[model samples]
Target: MKQFCSIAEILELYEQYGNEFYSEEITQTSHALQCATLAQESGATDELVVAALLHDVGHLIDLAQHGSDTTAFESDAKHESIGAQSLAKLFSSGVTAPIALHVDAKRWLCATNLLYHDSLSRASAASLILQGGPMTSDEQLRFRSHPQSGFAVKLRNWDDNGKALEPPELNFKKFAPVLERVCLK
Candidate 1:
């Protein structure tokens, strides 16, 4: 089995996977940068920001493993879960929790909040009800009870707005220091 990848290794994996999977849209580096910026601006911790930066990483593996054009959103086989699980093995719980719980948070909101359901992607719309069925009695309690619910809420917002743009200062090497600093601590 593959060993737990280091932070730099993870970053490299992200770069390679991103180039392969998102070549049509924004680059993986750009996506991670945007996510990190959003997380930082929103007052997330360093680790959480890192997690946000790598949230969609599972998509890389998903494309390779599932050989599909789109993610299977109607089932529990979500990229977020896959990404979260993958990240958890390498990072701390605080970082992985937001990544892992984001999809569930989206599902939770869709079930309970009428407005949330309409805004989901096509695949998400199909699986909204079955993945705990529109915030049932148990779901409602679970949603509220989750410790990362608030962080998940923020993460969702960032995920929605983390669209790529031409970065103002493409300091490709800037984040390297931050990553090193955090990892070495």
Candidate 2:
């Protein structure tokens, strides 16, 4: 529901609320930075790096819309959809599509990889139940057919691995150029 007009505005959103705890161990900003760092370190395209950075932005938007209640996480806030739709206003599908599908990628992984479910953090696993457990056969087929699904899977791996307690050396501002480059303008 938030209209992001520029990369600065999006950055400001992170600056404003990103310090909030994402899980017991990491803040939202730290998680984002770590994810983006992983993407960048792996030589992902700028769009994918930016997507990695901003994937959970919907949680911030939901926090703003709901006024600090924990209820957003209590149910399926659909943060992936919320973030992708909002980012789509200012970014191309290359950036937003991976974000949108990342959640489904998680579900798909859980369905396809027996060991994948064990890799999730407790918070992520709890959220997974709220996100409808794992994908059904039909859902997995649909997820596989999506063009962005592969990127989503990669992003999901980064998402899962990004929850480190140590803050990343690179901060959110470091990704500004990447975000600007991937902007729809």
List CA RMSD, all candidates. Answer: 3.5, 1.1
**TM-score, candidate number 2:** 0.96
Deviation in angstroms for 30 in model 2? 0.2
lDDT of 2 by residue, 1-185 (tens): 67788888888888888878788777889999999999998999999999999999999888777755674457899999999998877888999999999999999999999899888888888899999999999999999999999999999999999987876476789888888888887
Candidate 2 Cα misplacement greater than 4 A, ranges: none
Q: lDDT of each structure?
A: 0.66, 0.88
Question: Model 1: per-residue lDDT, tens digit, 32-125?
Answer: 6777788888787887777777777777667556554665443455667778777655667777788877777776677677877777655456
Predicted model with the maximum TM-score: 2
- Over 4 Å off, model 1: 1-3, 20-29, 64-76, 121-133, 164-173
Q: Give the worst 10-residue stretch by lDDT in candidate 2.
A: 64-73
Query: To one decimal, what is the Cα RMSD in angstroms of model 1 from the true structure?
Result: 3.5
